[model samples]
Target: MKFKSAFYLLFFFSAFLSFDGVAQNKHTFEIKQGNFLYDGKAIQIHSGEMHYSRIPHQYWRHRMQMLKAMGLNSVATYVFWNHHEILPEQWDFEGDKNLAEYIKIAGEEGLLVVLRPGPYACAEWEFGGYPWWLQNISGMELRRDNPEFLKRTEIYINRLFKEIGHLQITNGGPVIMVQVENEFGSYVSQRKDIPLNEHRSYNAKIKDQLVRAGFNVPLFTSDGTWLFEGGAIDGVLPTANGEGNILNLKKAVDQYHGNKGPYMVAEFYPGWLAHWAEPHPAIDASNIARQTEEYLKNDISFNLYMAHGGTNWGFTSGANYDKKHDIQPDLTSYDYDAPISEAGWATPKFDSLRAVIKKYAQYDIPDIPAPFSTIEIPSIKLTRVGDVLSILEKQKSVQSTTPLTFEQLNQGYGYVLYSRKFNQPISGTLDVSGLRDYAVVYINGEKVGELNRYYNNYTMEIDVPFNSTLEILVENMGRINYGPEIVNNKKGIISPVKINNIEIEGNWEMYTLPMQEAPDLDNIKKNDVFNVPAKTKQLQGKPIIYEGVFDLSEVGDTFLDMENWGKGIVFINGINIGRYWHVGPQQTLFIPGVWLNKGSNKIVIFEQINSELKSEVKTVKTPVLNKLK
Candidate 1:
């Protein structure tokens, strides 16, 4: 039978004790007799992985309910480090980054949680959740035994535990398992040129450290099925990550875990990530159903890598490189076509997966929630605020002998402009040796050819005029969060702003444009901040902050249609919704109703390209997510 009274008593008691003394709370989850046991009963985990940083704070439960409706038993999430700690000794867990709130919501909805507190989480995230400032530490080495890295890692882990550690099932919270150093087996060995043997030692060390720090819940490791030797720590549970080939994967797990019971497929690829220029990858619903059935039939457990992939707001989207080390930046809309849509709506894949999972789940699947509707803004005439240069003149600038990284300048996201003047006429090759990601070159306030570090385009031939002003605007499209390259992801022009292999000398002015949201439109023209919308025309090449008003009859979740616009970001009522690119696959940004007012609403657009566009920004129920950049 059902023991509701006993459960409620235990839950309330845990809550009472948890508030007073977190360490006093106690619950148990362990492996016994070849089965995963929770509260003295064996249970199979049908789970999905979603990042709270990707989705908004308000939609956490809506997404959890969506996960439950899809017939998953538990929710898995990656606790991104950079998202929480933007700087040393500082943290932001409020709003969307609130990990504790998300976990409690999952528990309230009758779902369990698996927390992946990655000192490094390569979920297409910038620096793989690593802070950009770590590079400034003289002897800092990440994902290793370096003292500086270890010390900082311990501090972050300790800080995280204080926030959500008490929420673990042991303390009446839903978190059941905590992962150790994500997917380390593949990258660590390759990066250090060491064999898998050393990887085992490193993982064991990391796992031991986590244990010592008091994460008493079951600890596990996740990696590809083929990279078994690389990622598996001898004592921790070994989970495979793949979309196809289940039988061999199980065999590999058995071999690694010493033929242990309770097999796990940690990262099942539901949908693929989209790079700027590549086609969005959509998997067949039939394939998803088949895989779910196969795993259930064999008594195997799995977690879809992205049950609901959300947006990568700001400059947090990452890039991938070839053997040549050219970057392929991922699109901002993570909207991985999972069973749950990015806007938290059900899809055909959800229906198929739900039907198949119903046959095996001991608990009844809940009814699906209706999706939030959309609204239209007939037209929004965005008034031009100013260009990057004009905005720069107002911002605090530092004259440096050399260029500074984003972290060095205490800037987190957005673009950086490095400016210098050449008195004599000089025309040859312009070389920015340490161009971290992408750059736009200009001379004498005129545009020049662009360069992208992702494709190894570093040097360019430019025609410089006499007494020309040289400006190199660098955009950290994203940082490489995976592989050996992730140790230190410092943004912007790292070294000297050079020209033709010679360092440009002079009092160099640096402007940091970590654009989060535009200032109040009425106050914009400290320089030319307040120009009438109807009269402003002819915007220069520099990025302009465009603003206007749109009347709304009612508020709901809507997609900002950008079919004809260039790449930039959108803010509504001073809330940063997300970024939008001319790139196909994600032509619109999701704007939630919670951010809108009843009648008059403000719309701000930071257009990096052409300013001319349709007078009205319309909203549609459908999203265009199949096109490439």
Candidate 2:
């Protein structure tokens, strides 16, 4: 009798998971006569969007298990073009970005895939996920049908499809649907540079490229209901994505995917993205349940915009701007107040949403996977190992009549320092109206004042000494990912540094400080000059590299409390985890267990502003994401 019961349970599970099996026989899924029929059987796409590049590879299974446990049947992800192709003609697909491996692994977990391979995925990702070198292209207008941009976009899309095209459902893999270009209506509708036909042509071209590259899965395009008219293309399933107002969404869907029947909310935002120096974006867990229930009650197919809002990791975080042109640099912690937090632990939001899904999907949900471990490590003693001045001694310098931007210097990400010597003594407001972002003004390597793009604090009047060497260190915090301004979002002192509205005339020395990799700890530990200012407040205004070493009997994930610290980037064991600032909202840096060691570990931080307190770091069990501006 027990054996018979077990067989029945297995059969029931298999029957309920038919959507996954839909790929097994015909290898084709279709939406006809108002139903998404798989093997002629209707199936609901209970899905969530998670990026493999955002989450650590080691925890991929853990997160997927969490998603499945939520009664979800499918997963969606975006392929970031800039991440793989860092330089011109060079590419990498190994490690976390292995598209084929990520899809195969999701299939192994019994979940179907919905691939959103965007040559332009604007998920608060840097440059809307376009490589920096693309800006150097002559007459290149991105996200349009310009020949140069199109040629490059096609090259990247084709190369990426070659990696995962065979894995589509039609080809006997878990991938079922592929998205054309990301929401372009709200963007292109206001563009004065590109023509309307070019926008329409580019939209069609993206789909054509996908088909030519062997993606036989059903194709779809997504946008907010308001943008459907401009963003959607003919013959493609148009999907709506936004937080609430389901009534209007349904009406819009009816007009577009109306006759087609099955519709999808490709990006359902449970929580929103927050920027540094701003209030944390927190949504009530109850609201998450209510909205999710609304989708289910209407029998609408939806995917959580972010099931697990993992870390931005490294220098990949992007920035955004408002109508006022206020630049808001996104906090490094993508924690997004998501159901699964940055530390990969379940929150109340997860529990609330799970109950809704269980009732709506009518599936027997499994036990939640054991929560990932977290530990509070002992205090780490950090020593100032290097100063910005010493590090510049051995670097190459660019001399230009005007201060060149990062793109002009063939540089991307990280910070750049512009130095110039003024033989004439002048006193006036140093007009840095052309400053792309933030800069620390220095008189002979000493910090004077800072000009910021966020608050438009771009002018400073200071005394000028004769033959005084001036140094300005500018950080490319992030480029504008979404806006009419993206085409010109180059970083650093983009134009010639001017004094009193007149461009300062002088030969400039430029240093490229793209901190892609961590510096050698041995060299830092050997240098003692960096200790001078740390011990005394005299020269604390310059950027300093603080190194720390600690031994651990065992290693587990922990959050580094950076509440007392200032703006800077953190490196653990010679790997950049991302940036941190003493702004409201995210003040903790997640140190993953996968990046830690049991024996010994090295940490280096390049701090732009010195913490008022001693150079100290503490590991905490939880993250503080509720701070208001």
Candidate 3:
């Protein structure tokens, strides 16, 4: 028995040598005879999913190290389209947006790559990873056979390949496979209006786009096991997602690929995503351990959906819809209850999975790296600088006969203000039909009530006087990232406004407040005049921007406790950290150490409703993920 164990260890060590040595030179990675062949030798790929855009650039190496330590040989990542191309003809690939640098760093850390460059990645990303500008293009029908959408997609694919094309396996880089499109099979089932041939043709065009862009790696498609008939690309490997039944997965792949081998689970869930106002989702550590062991025992390659889910930071988080929750926007933290916490600390799930790998993995596992340090900050004083209503009036506005959607106005994300004056006194049902998300109705700058789309609330009773201005401040919480409704996710008002069932059209002023960059508090004039009439009510129901400064002797990652504050977004040193609501489930926003300075640092908040008028924020060493309203 001892001799047999020694021989097995020697055999794996020699196989590792051959794999590592060939990676430096040109290598052949293919599927043949029921196995994944690397230089004509069978190998199992142990990969984990992590997005480069979601994590800070400075900590990429550290996160990759964590994956390696967990016994993962390969790292998979989705290249978000909107993250790279903010606007049409305006592409950003430097600094944190650098893809080539990220891939090179992964290779340096001794991990192979499986790239998922999605023109439409439904990873709870804004607009399903489609650039907002695409909605403005004439004749644009996304994720379809529309020429306009395909033309723009082709342009983006070509430009992206120019940046990381040489990193493919054929070019002596670590990249092994490239995914064609993300879960098109599920979309096909949802959108039955489009013929199956069109869906297949659209997918084929996307695959062609990737190949034309110079990706010579093995191309593949991923879908749920039952939908392989709709999602599988001809002559391309089909992989399963969220499948635990290895037998079912193998049968599905075999049925689609004519009984070939080299089966893989593209997205195996170790943990699930959490949303605001919902219980934080968690998978038992022991259950995950059993699953990991099952995969190893079956010789099946699988990638953990999110080995380390990071923050969604800024306005990039997306929304989902179902019969249960009307429109559930994802929480700011993409923690996903993953094996690695949002702050880069390993959880019990990590330990259990690592133990399984140590016992069954053919290759040797690396030691877990030291965890990152965190610090707590004392409460810092904040003061109201200016209210959003007053500041918004100063910006330019367009006069329209009817309220315009964010896409129609050519504004991507953020808040939009719609204003109109009533000539005659009117009181009754004040309803806004086709409201994209949330809106605060105001009469002469005083808050009357609010309509939240998440709850399907769009009507309210109101009493108005003659010659009073009626304003509706609408916020684009996030666009739908999944399901058939994503095609109609136009922000702001999509329909018309009505009073007592009478349409209020014409002479409307619409202001596009994208909030792409945080306001420069030092330059903006401060306002001492209060908007609320009550003496105790300071900026009640008013959108106010508060500014504060704190000094940090040493820099370390921390969580800003926004439990006391109401719904708003926080910015540190002019960088938009993320959004926080009093609704619960997510009571803190992560502050990366890299974003902090050693000396004085500035913080800003765009508070939409401050009933308590709280003017301070504290940083804690630990996160509060389960706090509820």
Among these predictions, the greatest lDDT belongs to 3
Candidate 1, residue 66: how far the Cα is off, in Å: 1.2
Best-fitting candidate, measured by TM-score?
A: 3
Candidate with better lDDT, 2 vs 3: 3
**Compared with the true structure, what per-residue lDDT tens digits does model 3 show for residues 26-49?**
666777787766676677788899
Using Cα atoms with residue i matched to residue i, what is each candidate's TM-score against the true structure?
0.91, 0.94, 0.95
Question: In model 3, what are the clashing residue pairs, if there are any?
Answer: none
* Predicted candidate 2 versus true structure: per-residue lDDT over 131-171, tens digit per residue: 98888899998888888988898898889877877777676
Of 1 and 2, which scores higher on lDDT? 2
TM-score of 1: 0.91
Sorted by lDDT, highest first, which candidate order results?
3, 2, 1
Prediction RMSDs, each to the true structure? 3.9, 3.8, 3.1
Off by over 4 Å in 3: 1-24, 526-538
TM-score of candidate 3 relative to the true fold = 0.95
